[model samples]
Target: MKRTRRRKFPPCGRVGKWASKHSRSGKHMKTKTGKKYWLFHALSILLILMLVALMCLNRGNPDFQNYSNFYWDKDDFLKRQHEMGFFWLTRLGRLLNLTYEQFYTAITGLGLFSLIAWFYRYSKYPALALAFYMVFPFLLDIVQLRNFLVMGIALWAFSLLMEAKEEPTYRYLSLSLLLLAGTIHNTAFIYIPFWLVLQWPSIWVILSSGLAFTVSLLIPRFLTEASLAQSSSHVLQRYAYLFRGQVSLPGRIFFISLSLALCLAVYFIQYSLDQDRLLEAGVKPKAFQSLSQLAKKLSYLSFGLMPLFFQSVDFFRIFRNFLPLYWLLFSIYFLVPLKAQHKRLEKLVLSLFLLGILCVTCYVLLIFSNTDNVIRTVFKENILLRLIELRGQ
Candidate 1:
């Protein structure tokens, strides 16, 4: 008798089965995404811990001695021709009755945590970006503690700037963070004009960066330390040293070639993105587009200033500031897109490219360790072993 009611129930049964399957698939995806997120977090934390251990345990580091001296002499520290953020940090450390070791370690840990956290949160391939950072700039940044701290702050501000397009209030917040970073290290001010023109066309960005580089070149020709030393402005006087030194011929060639190669790679990636409409289909189209444009502009600026690198190694600091953007660009456009293709050839190519990067990075680290007495401290001993020896001593 119930057979009459059971008739024509096929649509409802099919719909129920489809919904169940869809829900299971969604749940699996969510679980997979969550695991990946935690994995990245764990990796980031481990990296931060390793870096902090290396920097903090290396008491023989020349910069550590210099920073300690600065900490001991509060009045002299405040009076020095340095940014106030460092002075404030020293003051706070003293107020807390922290020893020089504790103070240094705390600041170093905090700065590194911030920097790695930013990379993990925003970067498409955070691990790759972190690896790139370690290869090129990690040692240098740790040596220059103040600059490292400023970089951490500047990157945080940059994250805010990235979100500013969606939420206007983020723009002001980004500006405030940048100002704070400037107080820590005046180079942060260089990012202000960049932030101002983030929405500009790629061509305009290229032109402006070229013009800026040209002006920078002219400034060295016109204004020497002698001229700047006589100026009333402390900022100008502080930068006078940049106009003094001459980089070696080998150094010039190496840096210029590296910059040129990187610039060409970025241009190639940009071309590919455009031709394939990858940006349109990318995870975050607008954000990635801005990243691509900014990366190109910064690459051009970095390359254009390579000649200046010959004038002074200090000019390379500008290149360092732009380095992270390059990592992000390459990771996003080059690697992420390739990953989506799931082709064995693409995967093999990616593996080889990464291997090449790692080899180059190792070569650089070895060179730095051998050439720079100060940097040699970093590689002299295993950090854990060093700490244990210190404890025993």
Candidate 2:
């Protein structure tokens, strides 16, 4: 009779433990990757498809109609709500004679690609990064063109900042790009605060946000009394808009509740993981502290949106500034096991995050399926069929 051998399986209690600890172990990485890695990627791919589906389904929107006003008359690219960069983009599309919808679709594709390029640098979990970008921000991107562009490039700048400590070139470049990012969308202004706090100490970010919030309240009074509100830039107008109670109550509640869940889930993961960073290779205490500080600041910035949600339902749009970091931390959280507190806090946070992630994914899927265009996009129309028809025309 041939000798039989037995293989050890990870225990039920320590499944999260073994996965976190041993996935890095040379002995276990290959054997364990199939179980943990595949599931994560599968979920990621599903979310990515939904992201694309949303953009594809929304071939034309109010923004496109706005763009059409400029394109039809072929007017001079004047300084409007859209900054120079955006007008130039529209100009190029109009010059090409591509329909506004086609041009928008193409550029949106490029934007998604640019996002992938920026996020690919700091993350190992590509699926999660793509999902994060393509999901929560999906609604805003559908209607807001400049914001989509600004968020993508600002994140590109943030990716540069993440490496600034080790690379002086990246440090200077990150700051310059951040300033440039501001011109594309006023929302990019948040990058300066994040960069400053990260370079100095992480604690100041909360103080900065508190100060800005106070300052924003003061501005609305000035803008209201003065004739400047009408002449102000779109972004400034947005600030003026956010300071007053302009948002719907039901809409604000839903927006704030969703944002709260995401922020809480991310914060818990970071808190749980901070305890174990010392164990990872090349992860210094000071470096991890810097990251922890960034996480805290981002979380606080995210929470600030809650009060703003009352004033502007679009307040959640600002979360785009901190989005890359959230996804980055999440990617790291999954990669790094909860070691210090070991199993208890680890599983608790991990389970919470998993629950939150799944809920968000399912929610997006359900919402997308309910759209009228989805049926048209899936069966009656598709990229390939559209391409053939365009050629025939």
lDDT of 1 by residue, 130-160 (tens): 7667766777776788888877776667657
TM-score, each model? 0.77, 0.68
- Among all candidates shown, the one with the greatest TM-score: 1
Clashes of each: 0, 0
- The superposed Cα distance between candidate 2 and the true structure at residue 75, in angstroms, equals 7.1
In candidate 1, where is summed lDDT lowest over 10 consecutive residues?
274-283
Q: Candidates' lDDT values, in order? A: 0.68, 0.60
Clashing pairs in 2: none
lDDT of 1 at 69: 84
